[model samples]
Target: MLARASAATTALTDPGDRLAELCARIAGRIVFTTSFGIEDQAISHFIMSRDLGIEIVTLDTGRLFPSTYTVWDETEQKYGRRIRAATPEAAALSALVADIGINGFYHSKDARLACCHVRKVEPLARALGGAAAWITGLRADQSGERAAVALESWDEERALIKFAPLFDWTRAEVAAFCAAEGVPVNSLHAEGFLSIGCQPCTRAVAPGEPERAGRWWWEDQGSAECGLHVGPDGRLVRDQPE
Candidate 1:
Protein backbone atom coordinates (compact mmCIF):
# COMPACT_ATOMS: atom_id res chain seq x y z
CA MET A 1 0.00 0.00 0.00
CA LEU A 2 2.78 2.41 0.91
CA ALA A 3 4.75 1.45 -2.15
CA ARG A 4 1.80 2.13 -4.37
CA ALA A 5 1.19 5.45 -2.67
CA SER A 6 4.84 6.49 -2.97
CA ALA A 7 4.91 5.46 -6.59
CA ALA A 8 1.74 7.38 -7.21
CA THR A 9 3.13 10.54 -5.64
CA THR A 10 6.78 10.32 -6.73
CA ALA A 11 7.23 12.78 -9.59
CA LEU A 12 10.22 10.81 -10.78
CA THR A 13 8.58 7.41 -10.88
CA ASP A 14 9.51 7.38 -14.53
CA PRO A 15 13.00 8.78 -13.74
CA GLY A 16 13.46 10.19 -17.24
CA ASP A 17 10.46 12.40 -17.93
CA ARG A 18 8.17 13.25 -15.00
CA LEU A 19 10.98 14.45 -12.75
CA ALA A 20 12.07 17.05 -15.25
CA GLU A 21 8.49 18.04 -15.81
CA LEU A 22 7.92 18.71 -12.13
CA CYS A 23 11.20 20.54 -11.81
CA ALA A 24 10.48 22.73 -14.80
CA ARG A 25 7.10 23.66 -13.44
CA ILE A 26 8.33 24.54 -9.97
CA ALA A 27 11.77 25.87 -10.75
CA GLY A 28 13.02 29.46 -10.18
CA ARG A 29 10.40 30.62 -7.67
CA ILE A 30 10.82 27.50 -5.59
CA VAL A 31 13.20 27.52 -2.61
CA PHE A 32 14.46 24.58 -0.55
CA THR A 33 15.74 24.71 3.02
CA THR A 34 18.24 22.08 4.12
CA SER A 35 18.82 21.00 7.70
CA PHE A 36 21.44 18.42 6.64
CA GLY A 37 19.08 15.56 7.50
CA ILE A 38 18.99 12.49 5.26
CA GLU A 39 15.55 13.38 3.91
CA ASP A 40 16.68 16.95 3.22
CA GLN A 41 19.77 15.74 1.38
CA ALA A 42 17.62 13.49 -0.77
CA ILE A 43 15.48 16.42 -1.89
CA SER A 44 18.59 18.49 -2.49
CA HIS A 45 19.95 15.78 -4.75
CA PHE A 46 16.69 15.45 -6.63
CA ILE A 47 16.49 19.21 -7.19
CA MET A 48 20.11 19.57 -8.24
CA SER A 49 19.94 16.51 -10.43
CA ARG A 50 17.30 18.20 -12.49
CA ASP A 51 19.29 21.44 -12.41
CA LEU A 52 16.16 23.26 -11.41
CA GLY A 53 16.61 27.00 -11.17
CA ILE A 54 15.15 27.07 -7.66
CA GLU A 55 17.45 28.62 -5.11
CA ILE A 56 18.61 26.65 -2.06
CA VAL A 57 18.88 28.17 1.38
CA THR A 58 19.24 27.31 5.10
CA LEU A 59 18.95 28.94 8.48
CA ASP A 60 22.29 28.92 10.32
CA THR A 61 20.59 29.27 13.75
CA GLY A 62 24.11 30.26 14.99
CA ARG A 63 24.03 27.24 17.27
CA LEU A 64 24.11 24.37 14.81
CA PHE A 65 26.37 21.37 15.22
CA PRO A 66 29.76 21.20 13.52
CA SER A 67 28.54 18.21 11.51
CA THR A 68 25.77 20.36 9.96
CA TYR A 69 28.21 23.02 8.80
CA THR A 70 30.42 20.36 7.26
CA VAL A 71 27.49 19.00 5.29
CA TRP A 72 26.62 22.53 4.16
CA ASP A 73 30.12 23.09 2.85
CA GLU A 74 30.20 19.70 1.15
CA THR A 75 26.83 20.22 -0.48
CA GLU A 76 27.87 23.62 -1.81
CA GLN A 77 31.09 22.19 -3.29
CA LYS A 78 29.29 19.27 -4.91
CA TYR A 79 26.42 21.33 -6.30
CA GLY A 80 28.56 24.33 -7.27
CA ARG A 81 25.79 26.65 -6.17
CA ARG A 82 25.65 29.12 -3.35
CA ILE A 83 23.37 28.14 -0.50
CA ARG A 84 22.48 31.52 0.98
CA ALA A 85 22.70 31.77 4.77
CA ALA A 86 19.88 33.25 6.77
CA THR A 87 21.02 34.56 10.12
CA PRO A 88 19.04 35.35 13.25
CA GLU A 89 17.50 38.68 14.20
CA ALA A 90 19.63 41.69 15.06
CA ALA A 91 21.63 41.21 18.26
CA ALA A 92 19.45 38.25 19.12
CA LEU A 93 22.14 36.14 20.67
CA SER A 94 23.72 39.14 22.32
CA ALA A 95 20.45 40.46 23.74
CA LEU A 96 19.27 37.07 24.94
CA VAL A 97 22.62 36.31 26.50
CA ALA A 98 22.78 39.71 28.18
CA ASP A 99 19.30 39.38 29.64
CA ILE A 100 19.55 35.86 30.99
CA GLY A 101 22.94 34.48 30.03
CA ILE A 102 23.50 31.82 27.39
CA ASN A 103 21.95 28.90 29.23
CA GLY A 104 18.69 30.63 30.09
CA PHE A 105 16.45 28.51 27.89
CA TYR A 106 16.97 25.55 30.20
CA HIS A 107 14.93 27.34 32.82
CA SER A 108 11.54 27.35 31.09
CA LYS A 109 9.63 26.56 27.91
CA ASP A 110 8.83 30.20 27.16
CA ALA A 111 12.47 31.10 27.52
CA ARG A 112 13.57 28.31 25.22
CA LEU A 113 11.00 29.13 22.54
CA ALA A 114 12.10 32.76 22.70
CA CYS A 115 15.63 31.70 21.88
CA CYS A 116 14.44 29.65 18.90
CA HIS A 117 12.46 32.65 17.64
CA VAL A 118 15.39 35.02 17.81
CA ARG A 119 17.97 32.57 16.53
CA LYS A 120 15.97 30.70 13.88
CA VAL A 121 12.44 31.91 13.24
CA GLU A 122 13.23 35.60 12.81
CA PRO A 123 16.13 34.98 10.50
CA LEU A 124 14.19 32.39 8.57
CA ALA A 125 11.33 34.81 8.01
CA ARG A 126 13.74 37.36 6.59
CA ALA A 127 15.34 34.71 4.42
CA LEU A 128 12.04 33.67 2.91
CA GLY A 129 10.50 37.09 2.80
CA GLY A 130 9.95 37.12 -0.93
CA ALA A 131 9.67 33.47 -1.79
CA ALA A 132 6.69 32.26 -3.79
CA ALA A 133 7.10 28.68 -2.66
CA TRP A 134 9.14 26.86 -0.03
CA ILE A 135 10.26 23.25 -0.06
CA THR A 136 11.00 21.13 2.96
CA GLY A 137 12.19 17.57 3.55
CA LEU A 138 9.61 16.83 6.22
CA ARG A 139 8.54 13.21 6.39
CA ALA A 140 5.60 11.51 8.08
CA ASP A 141 7.89 9.27 10.10
CA GLN A 142 9.54 12.23 11.78
CA SER A 143 6.66 13.21 14.06
CA GLY A 144 3.07 12.51 14.96
CA GLU A 145 1.81 15.89 13.78
CA ARG A 146 3.33 15.39 10.34
CA ALA A 147 1.57 12.07 9.78
CA ALA A 148 -1.05 13.60 7.46
CA VAL A 149 1.18 15.86 5.34
CA ALA A 150 1.14 15.66 1.58
CA LEU A 151 3.67 15.84 -1.23
CA GLU A 152 2.61 19.34 -2.20
CA SER A 153 0.21 21.92 -0.82
CA TRP A 154 -0.37 25.61 -0.49
CA ASP A 155 0.92 26.32 3.00
CA GLU A 156 -1.64 28.85 4.13
CA GLU A 157 0.55 29.44 7.17
CA ARG A 158 3.68 30.32 5.25
CA ALA A 159 1.52 32.08 2.66
CA LEU A 160 3.52 30.23 0.05
CA ILE A 161 3.11 27.04 -1.87
CA LYS A 162 4.92 24.67 0.48
CA PHE A 163 6.29 21.47 -0.94
CA ALA A 164 7.14 18.48 1.16
CA PRO A 165 8.79 16.44 -1.51
CA LEU A 166 9.45 13.54 0.82
CA PHE A 167 6.51 13.82 3.20
CA ASP A 168 5.61 10.16 2.83
CA TRP A 169 9.14 8.80 2.78
CA THR A 170 10.39 6.62 5.64
CA ARG A 171 13.81 6.44 7.25
CA ALA A 172 14.84 3.48 5.14
CA GLU A 173 13.79 5.16 1.92
CA VAL A 174 15.64 8.36 2.77
CA ALA A 175 18.81 6.43 3.61
CA ALA A 176 18.53 4.41 0.45
CA PHE A 177 18.01 7.52 -1.63
CA CYS A 178 21.09 9.13 -0.16
CA ALA A 179 23.15 5.99 -0.69
CA ALA A 180 22.10 5.80 -4.31
CA GLU A 181 22.63 9.51 -4.88
CA GLY A 182 25.78 9.74 -2.74
CA VAL A 183 24.50 13.01 -1.29
CA PRO A 184 26.37 14.87 1.42
CA VAL A 185 24.62 13.95 4.67
CA ASN A 186 25.32 14.93 8.25
CA SER A 187 27.73 12.68 10.13
CA LEU A 188 25.80 13.08 13.38
CA HIS A 189 23.16 10.79 11.89
CA ALA A 190 25.60 7.90 12.06
CA GLU A 191 26.11 8.43 15.81
CA GLY A 192 22.44 7.93 16.81
CA PHE A 193 21.56 11.58 16.44
CA LEU A 194 18.38 10.81 14.53
CA SER A 195 17.18 14.39 14.87
CA ILE A 196 19.65 17.08 15.86
CA GLY A 197 19.38 20.77 16.69
CA CYS A 198 21.57 23.22 18.62
CA GLN A 199 24.27 21.44 20.61
CA PRO A 200 22.97 22.68 23.96
CA CYS A 201 19.40 21.52 23.39
CA THR A 202 19.99 18.38 21.33
CA ARG A 203 21.10 14.92 22.27
CA ALA A 204 21.36 11.54 20.58
CA VAL A 205 18.04 9.73 20.38
CA ALA A 206 17.72 6.60 22.46
CA PRO A 207 16.47 3.17 21.26
CA GLY A 208 13.01 3.83 19.77
CA GLU A 209 12.09 7.36 20.73
CA PRO A 210 10.83 9.65 18.01
CA GLU A 211 13.50 11.19 15.81
CA ARG A 212 12.78 14.74 16.98
CA ALA A 213 12.83 13.72 20.64
CA GLY A 214 16.31 15.14 20.93
CA ARG A 215 15.25 18.68 20.08
CA TRP A 216 14.47 20.81 23.13
CA TRP A 217 14.31 17.53 25.03
CA TRP A 218 13.67 19.33 28.29
CA GLU A 219 10.31 20.84 27.29
CA ASP A 220 7.01 19.23 26.38
CA GLN A 221 7.82 17.50 23.11
CA GLY A 222 4.63 19.05 21.70
CA SER A 223 6.16 22.50 22.18
CA ALA A 224 9.18 21.51 20.15
CA GLU A 225 7.92 23.29 17.04
CA CYS A 226 10.00 26.33 16.18
CA GLY A 227 8.48 29.72 15.41
CA LEU A 228 8.36 29.52 11.62
CA HIS A 229 5.37 27.20 11.36
CA VAL A 230 2.03 29.05 11.61
CA GLY A 231 0.21 31.90 13.27
CA PRO A 232 -3.42 32.78 14.04
CA ASP A 233 -3.81 34.45 10.66
CA GLY A 234 -2.36 31.35 9.01
CA ARG A 235 0.57 33.17 7.40
CA LEU A 236 4.21 32.39 8.07
CA VAL A 237 4.56 34.02 11.45
CA ARG A 238 8.02 34.96 12.60
CA ASP A 239 7.71 36.59 15.97
CA GLN A 240 5.45 35.72 18.85
CA PRO A 241 3.02 38.51 19.72
CA GLU A 242 4.75 40.51 22.40
Candidate 2:
Protein backbone atom coordinates (compact mmCIF):
# COMPACT_ATOMS: atom_id res chain seq x y z
CA MET A 1 0.00 0.00 0.00
CA LEU A 2 2.76 2.44 0.95
CA ALA A 3 4.81 1.76 -2.16
CA ARG A 4 1.84 2.08 -4.49
CA ALA A 5 0.69 5.28 -2.75
CA SER A 6 4.19 6.72 -2.87
CA ALA A 7 4.52 5.87 -6.55
CA ALA A 8 1.16 7.40 -7.37
CA THR A 9 1.94 10.57 -5.39
CA THR A 10 5.39 10.94 -6.95
CA ALA A 11 3.94 10.59 -10.42
CA LEU A 12 1.82 13.67 -9.95
CA THR A 13 3.33 17.13 -10.44
CA ASP A 14 0.58 19.37 -9.12
CA PRO A 15 -0.51 19.26 -5.49
CA GLY A 16 -4.19 19.39 -6.40
CA ASP A 17 -3.81 16.47 -8.79
CA ARG A 18 -1.99 14.49 -6.14
CA LEU A 19 -4.77 15.16 -3.69
CA ALA A 20 -7.47 14.18 -6.17
CA GLU A 21 -5.58 10.98 -6.96
CA LEU A 22 -5.30 10.16 -3.27
CA CYS A 23 -9.01 10.66 -2.80
CA ALA A 24 -9.76 8.26 -5.65
CA ARG A 25 -7.20 5.66 -4.55
CA ILE A 26 -7.73 5.63 -0.79
CA ALA A 27 -10.78 3.72 0.45
CA GLY A 28 -11.73 5.26 3.76
CA ARG A 29 -11.73 8.65 5.44
CA ILE A 30 -8.90 10.99 4.41
CA VAL A 31 -8.13 13.55 7.12
CA PHE A 32 -6.39 16.88 6.57
CA THR A 33 -5.16 18.75 9.62
CA THR A 34 -4.82 22.48 9.14
CA SER A 35 -3.35 25.21 11.36
CA PHE A 36 -4.55 28.18 9.25
CA GLY A 37 -1.00 28.92 8.08
CA ILE A 38 -0.44 29.82 4.45
CA GLU A 39 0.41 26.25 3.46
CA ASP A 40 -2.60 24.91 5.30
CA GLN A 41 -4.85 27.55 3.80
CA ALA A 42 -3.68 26.59 0.34
CA ILE A 43 -4.38 22.93 0.96
CA SER A 44 -7.74 23.83 2.47
CA HIS A 45 -8.58 25.78 -0.63
CA PHE A 46 -7.73 22.81 -2.82
CA ILE A 47 -9.79 20.36 -0.78
CA MET A 48 -12.76 22.65 -0.22
CA SER A 49 -12.81 24.31 -3.60
CA ARG A 50 -12.78 20.97 -5.36
CA ASP A 51 -15.33 19.62 -2.88
CA LEU A 52 -13.03 16.74 -2.11
CA GLY A 53 -14.39 14.42 0.55
CA ILE A 54 -11.28 14.74 2.76
CA GLU A 55 -12.22 15.45 6.36
CA ILE A 56 -10.64 18.74 7.46
CA VAL A 57 -9.73 19.07 11.12
CA THR A 58 -7.53 21.16 13.44
CA LEU A 59 -5.95 20.79 16.84
CA ASP A 60 -7.35 23.64 18.91
CA THR A 61 -4.59 23.85 21.55
CA GLY A 62 -6.61 26.39 23.59
CA ARG A 63 -3.56 28.66 23.65
CA LEU A 64 -3.88 29.88 20.08
CA PHE A 65 -3.48 33.55 19.22
CA PRO A 66 -6.46 35.77 18.42
CA SER A 67 -5.23 36.21 14.89
CA THR A 68 -5.14 32.46 14.43
CA TYR A 69 -8.78 32.20 15.49
CA THR A 70 -9.66 35.12 13.27
CA VAL A 71 -8.11 33.37 10.28
CA TRP A 72 -9.79 30.13 11.28
CA ASP A 73 -13.17 31.81 11.21
CA GLU A 74 -12.39 33.52 7.94
CA THR A 75 -11.29 30.25 6.33
CA GLU A 76 -14.51 28.57 7.37
CA GLN A 77 -16.54 31.50 6.13
CA LYS A 78 -14.67 31.61 2.86
CA TYR A 79 -14.98 27.90 2.18
CA GLY A 80 -18.45 27.50 3.72
CA ARG A 81 -17.11 24.47 5.53
CA ARG A 82 -16.55 24.08 9.23
CA ILE A 83 -13.11 22.68 10.00
CA ARG A 84 -13.64 20.20 12.82
CA ALA A 85 -11.65 21.01 15.96
CA ALA A 86 -10.01 18.39 18.13
CA THR A 87 -9.37 19.92 21.50
CA PRO A 88 -7.33 18.79 24.49
CA GLU A 89 -9.04 16.64 27.07
CA ALA A 90 -10.20 18.98 29.77
CA ALA A 91 -9.17 16.76 32.70
CA ALA A 92 -5.69 16.19 31.33
CA LEU A 93 -5.23 19.89 30.60
CA SER A 94 -6.45 20.86 34.05
CA ALA A 95 -4.09 18.40 35.73
CA LEU A 96 -1.17 19.54 33.63
CA VAL A 97 -1.70 23.18 34.51
CA ALA A 98 -2.21 22.29 38.16
CA ASP A 99 1.02 20.32 38.28
CA ILE A 100 3.26 22.71 36.35
CA GLY A 101 1.44 26.05 36.33
CA ILE A 102 0.01 27.73 33.22
CA ASN A 103 3.26 28.57 31.45
CA GLY A 104 5.41 25.67 32.69
CA PHE A 105 6.44 24.71 29.17
CA TYR A 106 8.97 27.55 29.30
CA HIS A 107 10.90 25.88 32.10
CA SER A 108 12.30 22.64 30.59
CA LYS A 109 12.21 20.60 27.44
CA ASP A 110 10.46 17.78 29.27
CA ALA A 111 7.91 20.19 30.63
CA ARG A 112 7.29 21.69 27.20
CA LEU A 113 6.91 18.27 25.59
CA ALA A 114 4.49 17.24 28.29
CA CYS A 115 2.46 20.35 27.64
CA CYS A 116 2.50 19.64 23.91
CA HIS A 117 1.49 16.06 24.49
CA VAL A 118 -1.51 17.11 26.50
CA ARG A 119 -2.43 19.90 24.14
CA LYS A 120 -1.60 19.00 20.54
CA VAL A 121 -0.42 15.38 20.23
CA GLU A 122 -3.15 13.75 22.23
CA PRO A 123 -5.88 15.68 20.48
CA LEU A 124 -4.30 14.86 17.15
CA ALA A 125 -4.46 11.16 17.95
CA ARG A 126 -8.16 11.47 18.55
CA ALA A 127 -8.57 13.44 15.36
CA LEU A 128 -6.74 10.87 13.26
CA GLY A 129 -8.52 7.93 14.76
CA GLY A 130 -10.18 5.68 12.16
CA ALA A 131 -8.67 7.74 9.36
CA ALA A 132 -7.27 5.72 6.48
CA ALA A 133 -5.05 8.56 5.30
CA TRP A 134 -3.69 11.58 7.24
CA ILE A 135 -2.76 14.64 5.21
CA THR A 136 -0.63 17.58 6.28
CA GLY A 137 0.60 20.81 4.69
CA LEU A 138 4.22 20.12 5.62
CA ARG A 139 6.93 21.22 3.18
CA ALA A 140 10.56 20.13 2.96
CA ASP A 141 12.20 23.55 3.25
CA GLN A 142 10.25 24.56 6.35
CA SER A 143 13.05 23.39 8.65
CA GLY A 144 16.20 21.26 8.62
CA GLU A 145 14.51 18.55 10.70
CA ARG A 146 11.77 18.20 8.07
CA ALA A 147 14.11 18.33 5.08
CA ALA A 148 13.66 14.60 4.33
CA VAL A 149 9.87 14.61 4.32
CA ALA A 150 8.32 12.34 1.71
CA LEU A 151 5.27 13.03 -0.43
CA GLU A 152 3.67 9.85 0.94
CA SER A 153 4.67 7.30 3.57
CA TRP A 154 3.36 4.84 6.14
CA ASP A 155 2.84 6.13 9.65
CA GLU A 156 3.60 3.00 11.65
CA GLU A 157 2.68 4.53 14.99
CA ARG A 158 -0.71 5.76 13.83
CA ALA A 159 -1.36 2.81 11.50
CA LEU A 160 -2.35 5.15 8.67
CA ILE A 161 -0.90 6.39 5.41
CA LYS A 162 0.61 9.88 5.82
CA PHE A 163 0.51 12.17 2.82
CA ALA A 164 2.20 15.55 2.46
CA PRO A 165 0.95 16.74 -0.91
CA LEU A 166 3.02 19.89 -0.69
CA PHE A 167 6.08 18.16 0.70
CA ASP A 168 8.31 19.33 -2.15
CA TRP A 169 6.93 22.88 -2.34
CA THR A 170 8.87 25.94 -1.18
CA ARG A 171 7.65 28.73 1.12
CA ALA A 172 7.70 31.24 -1.68
CA GLU A 173 5.68 28.89 -3.86
CA VAL A 174 3.09 28.40 -1.13
CA ALA A 175 2.82 32.14 -0.44
CA ALA A 176 2.44 32.84 -4.15
CA PHE A 177 -0.22 30.17 -4.55
CA CYS A 178 -2.17 31.53 -1.58
CA ALA A 179 -1.97 35.05 -2.90
CA ALA A 180 -3.19 34.02 -6.32
CA GLU A 181 -6.01 31.90 -4.85
CA GLY A 182 -7.02 34.52 -2.31
CA VAL A 183 -6.96 31.91 0.46
CA PRO A 184 -7.62 33.35 3.87
CA VAL A 185 -4.50 33.23 6.08
CA ASN A 186 -3.48 34.36 9.52
CA SER A 187 -2.73 38.09 9.59
CA LEU A 188 0.37 37.51 11.76
CA HIS A 189 2.23 36.13 8.75
CA ALA A 190 2.76 39.67 7.46
CA GLU A 191 4.23 40.68 10.82
CA GLY A 192 7.11 38.14 10.55
CA PHE A 193 5.34 35.35 12.40
CA LEU A 194 6.14 32.99 9.57
CA SER A 195 5.17 29.91 11.57
CA ILE A 196 2.37 30.45 14.03
CA GLY A 197 1.59 27.85 16.69
CA CYS A 198 0.31 28.21 20.23
CA GLN A 199 0.58 31.77 21.52
CA PRO A 200 2.93 31.16 24.47
CA CYS A 201 5.49 29.09 22.56
CA THR A 202 5.65 31.03 19.25
CA ARG A 203 7.15 34.35 18.15
CA ALA A 204 8.15 36.16 14.98
CA VAL A 205 11.31 35.05 13.24
CA ALA A 206 14.23 37.29 12.28
CA PRO A 207 14.83 38.18 8.64
CA GLY A 208 17.24 35.33 7.86
CA GLU A 209 15.80 32.65 10.14
CA PRO A 210 14.14 29.50 8.90
CA GLU A 211 10.35 29.51 8.33
CA ARG A 212 9.71 27.45 11.46
CA ALA A 213 12.20 29.37 13.60
CA GLY A 214 9.36 31.37 15.09
CA ARG A 215 7.88 28.21 16.56
CA TRP A 216 9.36 27.13 19.89
CA TRP A 217 12.07 29.73 19.36
CA TRP A 218 13.53 29.44 22.84
CA GLU A 219 14.24 25.72 22.48
CA ASP A 220 17.28 24.24 20.75
CA GLN A 221 16.93 24.51 16.99
CA GLY A 222 16.86 20.73 16.67
CA SER A 223 14.06 20.38 19.22
CA ALA A 224 11.64 22.94 17.79
CA GLU A 225 9.01 20.32 16.92
CA CYS A 226 5.97 19.71 19.13
CA GLY A 227 5.89 15.89 18.76
CA LEU A 228 2.99 15.68 16.29
CA HIS A 229 5.14 14.40 13.41
CA VAL A 230 8.01 12.75 15.29
CA GLY A 231 8.52 9.25 16.62
CA PRO A 232 9.51 8.33 20.16
CA ASP A 233 13.12 8.78 19.01
CA GLY A 234 12.32 12.45 18.24
CA ARG A 235 12.83 11.91 14.50
CA LEU A 236 10.29 12.54 11.74
CA VAL A 237 8.49 9.23 11.13
CA ARG A 238 8.70 8.20 7.49
CA ASP A 239 8.93 4.45 7.93
CA GLN A 240 7.53 2.00 5.34
CA PRO A 241 7.31 -1.25 7.21
CA GLU A 242 7.54 -4.51 5.37
Q: How many residue pairs clash per model? A: 2, 0
Model 2 agreement with the true structure over 5-109: per-residue lDDT tens digits: 746667898989999999988889899999988999999999999999999999999999999999999998888989899999999999999988999998988
- The parts of candidate 2 lying over 4 Å away from their true place are 1-3
Model 1 per-residue lDDT tens digits across residues 46-121: 7787787667788888789998899989988998877888887666778987876788989987788788888887
Query: Candidate 1, clashing residue pairs?
Result: 157-235, 157-236
Q: RMSD per prediction, one decimal?
A: 6.0, 1.3
Off by over 4 Å in 1: 1-23, 26-28, 233-242
**Model 2 RMSD in angstroms:** 1.3
Enumerate residue pairs that collide in model 2: none
